[model samples]
Target chain A: MAEFFTNPLVQSVLVPVAGGFILTGAIRFANGRAKGPLVAGAAVALGFLVGYVLIVGLPPLPPVSNQQKLAYVVAGGLIIGFLMDFSRRPPFYRELVYIVGAAAALYWMALPKIAGGTAWTYLSLVALWIAAGLIGYRLEKSRANVVNACAPLLVAALGLGLVALFGRTGSYSQLAFSLATAFGGFMLWNWPIARYPFGATLLLGGAGALVTIAYALALYTEASPYALAMLLLCFFAEPVARRIKLPAGKIGEAFRPVAVGAVALIPALAAVAVAYLTAPGQEAGY
Target chain B: MRTRSIIAGAAALMASTALIGTASAADNYKIDATHTNIIFIVDHLGFSNMIGQFQSFEGNFSFDGKSVEGASVKLTIKTASVDTDHEARDKHLSSPDFFNVQEFPEMSFTSTKFEATGDKTAKMTGDLTMLGVTKPVTLDVTFNKADKFPMDPNVFIAGFSAKGTVNRQDFGMKYAAGAIGDNIGLWIEAEGHKQ
Candidate 1:
């Protein structure tokens, strides 16, 4: 239990829940408009719970081979989805939720062999992000909201440029890849890209990418079973901040979603450098 | 008595001729660097296999009726020639993890004993010194063929191949546990000619 206190996964999971309550409570205390935050919280919790049931519970309804082991993964996915959904109200909050969730997933997934583990994952991620950013840009262009469309594309391009040049390291690389991939997938189905966006698409894809990259890269050396679910911190940060009524709009909102994503990238890029330096020479076989 | 003496003298001359033929038939052959290879393989993150070969080596051998009467080999592998396609990992292998070329410049293997096991097979024992660790290793060897070169009769050619396994840790080389297996499998193919 004490270990859980220090674990990233536990913190990530609880932050959103606590934030939801605080958001609703704060809104009630400040503006007496608790309804929006409360509804958002309930939607997040419901989305998370339902998503968990569908993703984790449904797959092994009859109890397949590794149902018990998959319990945490399923639960994590649910929480992430809930958080992403919960942040939907302020628009930028929703984007922040997705970005944080995606970033967290990426960082956790890329491990010991960061370059070998996340290079390809990063490539695929960058490609997806570019596509999504493009779609978002095109949509905004159609509506003459060129700024919004250009925003995602510009951010994505900058992120891609950074990744291509320096490459990601340590825990951060995994998260970066996850965030990029998730954002891309989300754009493919969401507002500007899709007429109807499934609530769990970005949440699940982002979380799943995190798992796959970590599993593929074997980056779980520092990872706990719950580390995967910890993106809820970023996911819920915006909603929680909104409930507190932090002043600012548009640019502030846009920046909020990417804040945690950027933090997550630092450690990831560092890890990549460390792993590359430590491993040094190439193996006989490629 | 005179006839018997003549016959005995003729038999003595015949015996001497046979001895000379056997002596000149088996010539000592030196490794021809133009044709020799030392290769290795290892698993890369349980995902793919990486393969590469060393560029240079030297070998020496001589045989008599499938028996290795005398044989010795010395090989110097150029540390810089290591390649595994991926630029990053390749650089690492040449670093402190495995080769550590800076501290221990060259890896060498010298054979001290050769024991014939069958008509074309033998177990060659040698000391493989790498990263300052010297360990006795036995290699499974096949004595392929030895004969006068078609182009140059003065230089006789002899070919052989040997295989062995050495623990990387045994040589003070350590790295990824699951990524690169400990027991590094190595194979060498060589041909030698009278120098």
Candidate 2:
């Protein structure tokens, strides 16, 4: 029992879930507006803050590059807030905002690689972020917060697996855990009848987390390209689920997230298989 | 008697000149990267010690036999160059939990003081900066030898070996503290050529 509690996986899952619940409950109580864009925006902001605090305190933080990535996360949140405010605006105006938001997120997501003078890497990361953001946006539009939130959770699980397989720990892994926990917390409010929409939060947070995971794998881990390809492919789950027909009412509602999750799992499992088979030796060379 | 006095005075002048030359023998040297190595050791779950090293580094030093304070050394290591024999482990070491190589790509040490403890050894104090955190550390350094390279006499070489221990927590590396040892031992063997 002590060992279980001490386990990083447990801490990663439990802390954020508890924090998310507390934060969401507090916001609901304070504002008395359980539904709408404002509540959703507030929930996203609080969830991220709480999750960040629980995972990594400000004092002994990760590297500056990872730290700078937070700015992108905040920028993503702000974009969502803007979208929520102008939701009733003309379609053209909303589309413009999304375009600008995507561009900004892509730039910030690829900033480290860009600064490192790896143009190809930067371009590839931008493409991946755009794809992820689109998938998340489409899912949110379909009123499927559960599916949107689950994307990050899946990616986080993969990161944790990678850590265990390699027997190494780092900030990327910690961030992955935080992301998973945050989404887990978000899920409680998101299920049955969502207290608030998690569209923007999922898009921004998911993209940010995925980008970090990809970079960590590419730069540090000996994970095969196929593994990374599978990870990226998981983002298509939302689009695929949109095509599925299901029974109406609560059954369909619950089934929607499950369907999306199943689609994602296919690629995720494949990535794991590739990684396990091609795993490198435990020795490092200078 | 007058001739004897002149001979003694010449001899004294020669002796003074030789002493002055020895006092000013402090030579500046550039690090010979090919021959210098920066190695480290950390405890792994109390099972065994895990040894590692950095592949890319550069350093320089000024050796002064006359005054220990005149001696100074500086080294800069690429944090991403860390190797523990495993690609995955090395990658993890360079990740944000430890070096955060993407952000703080370089770790450096600059000597602040050198106290001669014996004819061939000294205590060197320096500031080691990693992950944007700087801390003062002392290394027990031993001068192995100084001579012209056998292959290339034109290049004068100086060799030194140093050992130190630093608490990883001090540099903000507090991940898996109980599982991995906090204190990391550093062992460096360096060779520099006179510039």
Candidate 3:
């Protein structure tokens, strides 16, 4: 816990989540939707969590051969956009059931190996991202919202782009870039939505970004075998904290997931670097 | 007429066999360091594989068609010449994990048995010493071609390639289990001239 508090990545992740919540809260309190800030905060937090889990926990995915990783990025952006359009309204059993089932399906579809260090893996990732966007569109239809639909698709695209590019290189870089991109997108999108209901698109893009980044990080880097656990910690943190009645901006509230991401990122990168340095049998064959 | 044809065919077979035996006769040859190559490769990560080759070495081999039954082959690879572009890694390869130049300086492979499998191929079993561990390995030997040297016509060139795999652990090299695989594949292409 002490180490977590002192880490740079943890510091980086929490600053925005807590600060954004406060800013959104102030804006909502003034606009008479005192709950608006809370809603936006929840969406941001949720996006971050889902993204972190998918990237860090998974195995090295198969690479797409025909196209580059851009395909995955575009697909992810579109999904988040679609989802942002949907997730609004009173709690309904049918929608909830569909979301749960869709998430499970996405997880299953993502299990095939995609990291072949070829263009194919990137292309497949893009296709999957786009499919997720379509699912987001369905989720938005239930809520009858436009801004929310766009948010998820946009965020998914951005997140997928980060993963495809930075994730191609290293684990720590993936986590760092993913968190940075998703958080930034959320902050920018939250401003307009807190004043008005932009719909499921916001959540879709935000969450999609996080998910794609996390998945890309996991696929490319040997950062953590338990990336899913870290992501879950992120995803469930707000709800869990709310259950215990911790204030939105409290230190311990969002600290857990950030701490986990940091812990996984650093050591994994060091080990990889060490292996590269100490590699033996220096002879090339013809 | 049948008896005459049978005798002629037998005579032709004898003549051809004798001509081939003389023409393809083996002689003692020195492995020209300038032309020979020694290389090995392994998976760098799940991502890509890497290879390295020794640029220099000296060895000599010799045999005769009359003494193909007792043919012998030998090679001595310089422990220091291990190159994979990285200096630090090359040193480690020559260390205890590989050649271990301090303890056992030069790696040598000497054949104990040679069996001609066909017209241009043979199987040579030999003991290879590396890191002070000696193990028997068989070479899939192929006699590529033989010709008089362009520079020195008196000297003939006999090209041969021997390939085999040796477990690095069998030679007392066991480090980097998950990172670096165990099996060390080896290839030797040596040219020999009548010495």
DockQ metric, candidate 2: 0.27
The Cα error of candidate 1 at residue B7, in Å, is: 25
Candidate ranking under TM-score, highest first, comes to 2, 1, 3
Model 2 per-residue lDDT tens digits across residues B1-195 = 999999999999999998787667778899998999899999999999999999999889998644666789999999989988777777667666677776677999999999899888889999999877899999999999888899988989989999999999788776675678999999999999998
Per-prediction TM-score to the true structure, in the order listed: 0.38, 0.77, 0.36
Say which prediction, candidate 1 or candidate 2, comes out ahead on DockQ. 2
Runs of candidate 2 with Cα error greater than 4 angstroms are: A1-6, A34-56, A59-63, A71-112, A115-119, A144-170, A199-202, A205-226, A242-245, A282-286, B1-24, B33-35, B101-105, B117-119, B148-155
Scanning candidate 1 chain B in windows of ten residues, the lowest lDDT window is B95-104
Q: Which portions of model 3 show Cα errors greater than 4 Å?
A: A1-286, B1-26, B65-68
Q: Which candidate ranks first by TM-score, i.e. highest?
A: 2
- Writing each residue's lDDT as its tens digit, candidate 1 over A1-286 gives 6444333232223432343234334433443343332222222233223322322223333321122123344345556654554454444554454445444444333322244546675664444343333332233232222122222322332233223222212222323332343233223222232222234422243333333333322222222212222221222232233344323855564444344335434434443344433442223332
Candidate number with greatest lDDT: 2
Q: lDDT scores for all predictions?
A: 0.46, 0.65, 0.49
Worst 10 residues of 2 chain A by lDDT: A34-43
Please give, for residues A1-286, the per-residue lDDT of candidate 3 as tens digits. Answer: 6445333344335543444345435544553554453244334434343333333322113322101232244244435434333344443433353344335434433444432336865664555454444444443452232233333333333333333232122223433444454455454543333243534334433444444444444443322323222222222222232234333554543443333334334433443444333333213211
lDDT tens digits, residue span A180-244, model 2: 56665656676655546544444444444444455545544445656666666666677787689
DockQ of 1: 0.05
Between candidates 1 and 3, the one scoring higher on TM-score is 1
